[model samples]
Target: MEKMGYQKNWNLDKIFLGGSKSNQFLDYIKRLEVLGRDLERCVKSYTTSLATNEAANLRKLVEYIGEIRVNLSQANSFITCLHSQNTKDQDAATLRGKVAQIESNFEKKLSKVKIILANTKQDVWESLIETKELEDYRFVLNEWRENTDKHFSDEEKNLISDLMADGYHAWGHFYNALVSSINVNVQVDGKEKNLSVGQAINLRSHPNEEVRKESHNALESIGEEKEELFAKILNHIAGFRLQVYKKSGVKSVLEAPLKDNRMKEETLNAMWSVISKYKKPFSNYLNRKAEMMGDSSMKAYNFWAPVTNSNQKIEYDEAAILITEHFSQFGTELEGFVKQAFHEAWIEAEDRANKSAVPFCAAFPLTGESRVFMTFGGTFLNVLTLVHELGHAFHNYAMKSVNGVNKRYPMSVAETASTFSEMIIFDAAMQKAKSKEDKLIILDEKLKCSVMNFMNIHSRFLFEQRFYEERKEGIVSSARLTQLMRDAIHEAYDESLEQPSTYSWVWTPHYYITQSPFYNFPYTFGYFFALGIFAKAKEKGNEFEKDYLNLLRDSGSMTVEDLVMKHLGEDITSEEFWEKGMEICVKDAEEFLKLTSLDDIE
Candidate 1:
């Protein structure tokens, strides 16, 4: 495969002329204000009647609202890219705040339209859904109708949406700021240095046992010192959600997330049931890993420890080449898209101080572009990160021609392309490994992802489930939160660890996000979902590539179950479908153990 030149930083100029202060950005904001006013007028003028002209006007209004949303997303994505590159950029922070307010205003206005649609006569609404102009948006229109019962009155809905900006969302901001500012003192090489919570956690993967132990202790200390505050944050967030749920007459807490994910409760239940049955294999992998590390039992900190000491670091250029070469096997389009991403400077992989610690791919629908952010440290893990994010970029590319509204996929299905990409690269790497030790290293990396998705994320789901259940009774204290976390971890891991971290909930930022409740399980969902897709790809080879692209393109237009059924001809709501994915993990675990044994003998 021919190598493509990679850009060190993303080209944000393609979105707007300036970062946050540019006249172009200012002009975009002004346009948003005008659009917001027009949308408000459109909604205010809407009536319950279903006249042909009114239906036509309604379609136009919906399209206009979608346009505004796309522009807003573009603005938000730009500012976020700026903020992520330089966390200390106060200008970016101010712009983000302004954008949030603009979005809130848009939401309040959009609620009126929602009320109009929700209250429309069933026959009229069905007629509108069947209209030629609105045929592409039938799913979104149907979703609006279904959500009619869950909504408050127009006035009440607007009030809740407005209040959520400064009320519910503020708590999440507070938690983010507090956690981001937290610095732990760790002694590295007989000198004490201050490290961010994320940096400290990275040490857990260090080759030295002492470093991992020290980093773990440092994290535990911070959790101990701030548990009460963290607990308050979680409690208040959950309490607010519960209060809203009760006021809105929502039957169950899970209903909101399941609806948001466009997934059914039975599907979630089926997936978890299959996952629960397969825990032993992951536990066995962990035990074997611990034994390889010369430990009596695996500590929580040892989960990410590397099995080999190769210290081989592939440069960014080499990593891109490797990813492109492997992706080429799937199809020309995928390979070309990845090459374009690298050549066009769509990725920001430079490591620098004050950059966001997390890796993410931000898609700008209005511009039909995506930007990837990550600190590449020239490790195998970094290569995986590159490909993983490229998976997201590929998905976005696949749907670039679709309307923005139809491109909005649920988080549950969002990971399908990315995890499938990882599977491709990992399989290729395993095949190309020259020795048992090398293959063991690749297997270990693969299993690490599996353990994270299956075990770590599963524990988070269990904890949140119990937390919400108990939050209905009253406030949960910090100590009690710790106990809940430990209990959940024990249950998920089957009590395999000698000591489970009680403060696990304290460090995770997922619990703090107001918009995304139960954000953890989607990772597990996406992983296994992708696994099943990967299995199909393996069986059908090149024939599956077209279906995979189609699946990615349609992700935003239909429910996950429907998408799977249309593409793979499988029922996602059954344990049988998820069990196929679990069987892959079991096979990987078995292969990992065998390879580790062979490496030991060699």
Candidate 2:
């Protein structure tokens, strides 16, 4: 059965019968609405009578909220699976809106309770969290109390949530649907073929230079054609954020994202400082890659082209075995979990039209299951994505049985297991290389990943920061956004790109994620954070697995600084911690340069 190529389509019937139109799923949705009202009532009761009914009320509030969280995670994950599988799924789209409203309602109610905790007398509030009933939740409770807003009334919060579901989130949903529905024509293997956005992306990694360039051209054409619509979406979504921040007297845009990520400004700066100083090495790698490709420098299309252009096809079945085999070297528990995920048909890697271009792993804690979404192109790069997303699935699996509050980790540290898994697979690939050329190919992939995390991500972060600054004054036009993106890439990539990108801002999903504010930097933060741990793994040798597992389990329960200190014995706020990760990447780029110069391949 494992030889049947690991079942490309996922078994969502295990989640809800009859897919999106299921009456059973509809019933579940109705029940969630009822639970949502119950949660709000519980929030009011728990907030108003902290003295008389502190013990019973506190337990009720936690129980109702926890139950709601389980239901919400299940409903949202299922519909999102449907949406991504077919962005044209109108039934799923409608259900998505309903689920968003329910989630928004629940969040605002939870927000009100946090406000109450901040206003309560200190001794009484401490006593409530100190109770045996809430001992496990004390950390999250304290976090809420400490971070509660000083502005925004209950009605104001509710109004914002209602508008957010229809306005802010709706715009993001529209963008994904529009992009996925778009079909473009590209010449692949001497034949002109119509491809969806996802398929076009697959061809961009083609071993043929012409294929990669043509595919990127077609994909960018979608961004260009949709530029005006995308610009409005960007402005409106960002406009919503700015208005909310202003309404709450928040002066800085980064403030909310930093707080949401449970990270300090110093930790972020520390990561970027390493990237800023070390950009030249990755830029050098890019230039060397271009030279090898018979070009002086790479254009936007060649930014992610396979360096060696290996036509090696690592089919899905082989990928499963390789991922688990390499994963087992680190730990049996993780390897076993990944194998189970494959056998259980938990991943949707179907190469189909109308599917999402990007990859993600969605955690459904209520069912103790996680679904990974991607188009498996059967390249080594696809295999890396396979391992990376599965790592996210396992992270959720590790913490699945924990209470909902404790399992809700911030995005900052969430990439630990995913990128950590990537290193295991990547290192294994490099070690198993059969020749100089093979080693160079694998090393090139590593450098590409590093470039994405640092230079490409920095360009996005810069664009967003400046875009928000511009959006504050007025609606930023499509031309201006393109110019901003171009300027950012030029600076961040050290002006190495032969033709800097202008359309990245339109397709980059990070800019549109309302759920995670400032979504791009956390990726780099997580990448190098995991890289640091991977290096530690080499030092710890046989003992690293246990420590790594402990780190993943505790990710949601600790602050970014405290978590790293406790697990890795390092301060993420210091340049030294990030410098270690940067060194690993820089060495790869240096090696790539040497290899290119030493061996001239036709």
Candidate 3:
């Protein structure tokens, strides 16, 4: 293997000192299972003392919950590292199931706490959480206690949580396993070659027009062939969710996602309202790119085709230096932390095959360390990906240090730091570009990401939104789901492309995720939320660093609206704050269009 700059592999040995068969890892799980039993006993005691020593028992229960959380985070984060580093590791897979069972056992007992809080009278509950021992966790406890009547009773809620581990989550795991077996055949250099879904996704960006089109059609055909099984997976998961909502007295499908994101409907409405007005400029960029490629219009396949005939690659060490140096320019301590992540070999960036292609950063709570996973192909896009995952690592570093439930934040605000890191590096790339083409590459890369958040994600959100409305009537057939997908694509693209992607529901994994509902909008929320933060940094200059770090720290402790007001002092439930993000996208698209319209290419 050719050695890249900095060691391409991460140091997981420091965490466990051995691989999947480590005896130390086994001992850790044994200790965790013992703790789970203790938590169950603590819950039992708390329920028995409800009348006499209610406050004191509740405090004791909180301490147990805190300890259990650290145990779960350490174990789960370690197993996730094992799996990502080698997807074919069967022992790692078996250990994941073991860790999951421990987590399930923990959740069963934890559900009792939620139900107890739900039944508590509002005045009494307020006074209970206001006590010295409980005040630190008031935000999370109040979140559960606020919507008391809309939830199930103790017996019903416990049954649902237990069933989900086997029934609901199993369906999700099966869908993932099934998708892994799908392979697409395409013609490559006068020979037929088989491609995995991940490989076919890469071919969509092939400079040759025919290759791009072939890969897209092959994947679409597979979706059509597998629609029946995929449809069952989609319907069963959604049907189970809708049934739970009906029993819980929740009126709309959006309610769970809104509450889960720790955000308000008004804020979601405000963000999408601004997004709805920005499609024309993005569509113009797509049309202009199609023209540059000598096509009358853009298709779903052509959307990823490169307009610049440049093949530029940045080495991993160069990317690391660029990311950390620029990160320091905007904050008090971001740069130093980034240097530690690189020098300590905390990132898994080896470029290899048979490895899971998903990229992420996992945080080990007890160790106060993080592991970043990605196959770092040498490109500007890869550099940005490294920067993006580091942003997530830094967010975890800022949060959860005090080790309580409040350290855990929602998906919406959790994305703030990662997206902000990308913005900082983006500025650095443009300012230090050695040539016009390099600058154009940076612009094109930014526009592609912006377009996805702006247009593609909107289609997913609209499709899921409408699918829920119709699911209330009855089970939507596999055929109707296709049309529903088309309806969303049509509305979101709005004459932007010659042909839009319609078989998305057949391939999109978001619809099958059992835990996260409405997996689409948090992305847009995160993107623009970071843009708002970036715009603030630009407006306030270096002094804004303190607030930026402070905001990341507080993300887990408050509602999205409350966090925004406390940090930026901006009204996010209105259109004005969201418009700032759209403006940044608009300017990027316009700049891309200007650069591509030159006579030199002609």
Instruction: Provide the TM-score for each candidate, comma-separated.
Output: 0.95, 0.96, 0.93
Mark the 10 consecutive residues where model 3 has the least summed lDDT.
Answer: 45-54
* lDDT per residue (tens digit) for residues 1-602 in model 2: 24646788898998889898988899999999999987766665553426724766676677668778888999999998998988878999889888888898888988888787788888887777778887777878889889877788778888888898888888888888877878899998789988887788777578887888878777677788889999998899999999989988889889999988999999988888889999899888888888888888877677667766466788888888888888888887887898889899999998878888889998888889999999998887798888889989989888876777788898987877888889998888898989888888889889888989998989999999999999999999999999999999888899998765588787788898888878989889889988888889889876887787778888877898999899888988899988888888989988888888877776
- Cα lDDT, all candidates: 0.83, 0.85, 0.80
* Cα deviation of 295, candidate 3, in Å: 1.7
lDDT of 3: 0.80
TM-score-based ranking, best first? 2, 1, 3
Model 1 lDDT, residue 549, Cα: 84
Q: After superposition, how far is residue 45 of candidate 3 from its true place, in Å?
A: 1.4
Q: Which pairs of residues clash in candidate 2, taking residues 3 or more apart in a chain or in different chains?
A: none
Model with the higher lDDT, candidate 1 or 3: 1
- From the highest lDDT down, the ranking of the candidates is 2, 1, 3
RMSDs, each prediction?
2.1, 1.8, 2.8
lDDT for each residue of candidate 3 in 84-126, tens digit (9 for 90 to 100): 6776678987887888788888987877777678767667776
CA shift of 283, model 2, Å: 1.3
TM-score of 2: 0.96
TM-score attained by model 3: 0.93
Residue range with the least summed lDDT across 10 consecutive positions in model 1:
46-55
Superposition TM-score, candidate 1 onto the true structure: 0.95
